[model samples]
Target: MNILYIVGEFPKLSQTFILNQITGLIDAGHHVTVLAKKSESNHKIHEDVSKYHLLDHVIYYDENGRDSKFFKGLTFIKSIFSFGYSQLLHKNHPIHLSWKVLLSSPNLILLYNRLKKEPLLDIDVVHAHFGPNGLLAHRLIQMGLIRGQLFTTFHGYDMLRFIKQKGDDVYTDLFQSKTVLLPISNFWKRKLEGMGANPARTIVHHMGIDVDKFEYHPIKMSQDIKIMSIARFVEKKGLIYGIQAVSKLIKKGYNITYSMIGGGPLEKEFRSMISNEGLEDHIRLLGWKTQEQVIEIMKESHVVLLPSVTSHDGDMEGIPVILMEAMAMGKIVVSTYHSGIPELIEHGVNGFLVEERNVDELVHTLADIFSLEDSISISKQARETVLNQYNIDKLNRRLIDTFERKTH
Candidate 1:
């Protein structure tokens, strides 16, 4: 099958889950094209990205003659006149006349021109990663640019912050169209329904990790506790609470070294917190590492800590793929009972869970995680959970089946 994926950015370090799906589809012998607003330059790109030669399949609007301001101005004028002529003939859909499409004409014009140059015009399926992209895809289809079965996955920010900014009726036209809404978790599924998405059309589809790649290695007891967090330094990640909890443990004289991998907008705030607590030695903020590098760090660590909470701006997580990766590697994980995390972690069963932002509870859980007699058992169960439910191989097959089914 030929598939087109529309995303905000390409080859992003923080969103490896999307990369996993793209590579998995390619491995399954499907043609996959990526349409991204822009490409990102990262210190280390994922190996699968290079192995699959994804860059060759990527399309950006700024490419070709669209890069020149003068050319863009001409294109914009042409789009306005063309749209005006279509309106005079009553040949365009209501969406073509909407303010959203009019204001987005510059991007739409460039994207349409870029897509026209592609070898394939009619795509089998167009799977957009976020809600805003879905809206864009809807508009594109309405303008007769691409033909496909539309599917959109609503991940965190689009459901929370985007909805807050655009109001609940933001997806009204999209929800009315023949678009399937796939929220990454039941948590976000509920949010989609709340925003008036057809319950019948909305399905809870999770972003999964490649369990086989993450070889399971049971954790062993150690004196110097090594904990790692693989997340952006953002408020929703509850990283500040993790820092505070680690600092409290250090004050209690626990032999602990916390290593945080990944960087984001709140890096300065988190660094300030680390410094104010005098935890320079105990905590290390290691910025963005490659997938192989991250796996190596996971091997050295005993536990993975991700204390997630709803940010002030209402940003949340949709079952972090990093948590699944750590669990698949048979490492003990301690995270907060927030969003769809509880669906992945059964407290005191496979992994430990504490209330969001409860530093006392987080500290106590960390203090006991090392000395627990069933640490190995918990680690084993964690791997089992991932292998059974969150395996990418299985999830990808299910995704393909859904994509193949004809949408009403």
Candidate 2:
């Protein structure tokens, strides 16, 4: 089968679940192409899959890659203006918040057109990752160039409030959706169904982790009971609250160390919190490290926490892949029962789940892990869940099955 894959971005440091899916599909002997968002970040996309070598089989396109930086900057400015104009409709414009959301179809049309030619996009199907990104690809198909089926996975943010604030109506224009992969919890899927996705086309496919990458065999085990979380230091991740909880844990002299990976707008604030809380030694903010760094931290740490909460702007985590990665690596996980998190974690069985933004619950969970002996057993259970359910083989098969059926 031929598939054209679209995504917002593919960071070079580490391969996200989309990449894993691409890798798996390509390995299964499917022809594929990737249309990705071009960003100013310095991460490289790993084209190591055998499919990438088979140029006819797999390829990736970055929408902004061909445009000049000056033109891109001007387009960004115009988007901000458009966002402000849309704001006359609402008191607060969540659209105007991030400058990156300014990247739009008009700016990327040429790139998509070029893709239509090279990938011969009329292949069997074109699958996009997020709503807007997928919708952009869908528009290209409507342009009469790419003769193929168009479907997009409504990941998070796009449908969650990010696209809504920009005045993009979710109710209008249906693409030829063969599937809408919602990795989020069932609760999130129910909300999407309420909003207007076809129930028949909707799918609950969790981004599976590569069990080969994370297992019970200790790799980088640190002696101290440590906690690690890899998320953008943003409001939705509950970083601010997580920081407070970690500080509270310190006050109790629990002899714990915490590490926060990934970089974002909240780095300075998180650092400030650590300083004010006098946790310089206990807390480490390892900003934007590579995949290797994350795995190292995950292996060495005793547990990982994903304290996600709905932000003021309605932004929330859509079933973080980081939690799956940690759990896959045989590390105990403590995530909140918010959004679709509970779908992955069953409290007291594999890992523990707490209330969203509950610092007390987070602290208590950590204390519980610290109090247990042969802690590896808990880690073993966490790894078992990932191996059994979140394995890439099963996920890829489900995805391929959907694509083959839908595109045909």
Highest TM-score scorer: 1
Query: 12-116, model 1: which lDDT tens digit per residue?
Result: 888888999998899899999998887775657888888889999998766443456687678877766755665634644543455455554466676765664
Question: TM-score for each prediction?
Answer: 0.93, 0.82
Would you list the clashing residue pairs of candidate 2? 12-44, 185-340
CA lDDT scores, all candidates in order: 0.85, 0.68
Q: Over the stretch 1-408, how does candidate 2's per-residue lDDT look in tens digits?
A: 878776655534434677778778888998777655653275533444333653344334443365677765665565446445655245354322223322544444344435535535457877777777666665556444455777667657776785666564543455234445443457756866766677776777777866786655433333466888888878888878778877887788767788988878989988888988789999998777666567777767777887888888887767788888887777777888777778788898778888887788788877776777566666677778888888888888888887777765
What is the alpha-carbon lDDT of model 2 when measured against the actual structure? 0.68
Q: Residue 153's C-alpha lDDT in candidate 1?
A: 91
How high is the lDDT of residue 290 in model 1? 89
Model 1's TM-score against the true structure: 0.93
After superposition, candidate 2 runs with Cα above 4 Å error: 11-15, 44-104, 111-119, 175-184, 218-223, 374-377
Distance from true position, residue 52, model 2, in Å? 4.8
Model 1: how far is 41 from its true place, Å?
Answer: 3.1
Clashes of 1: 0
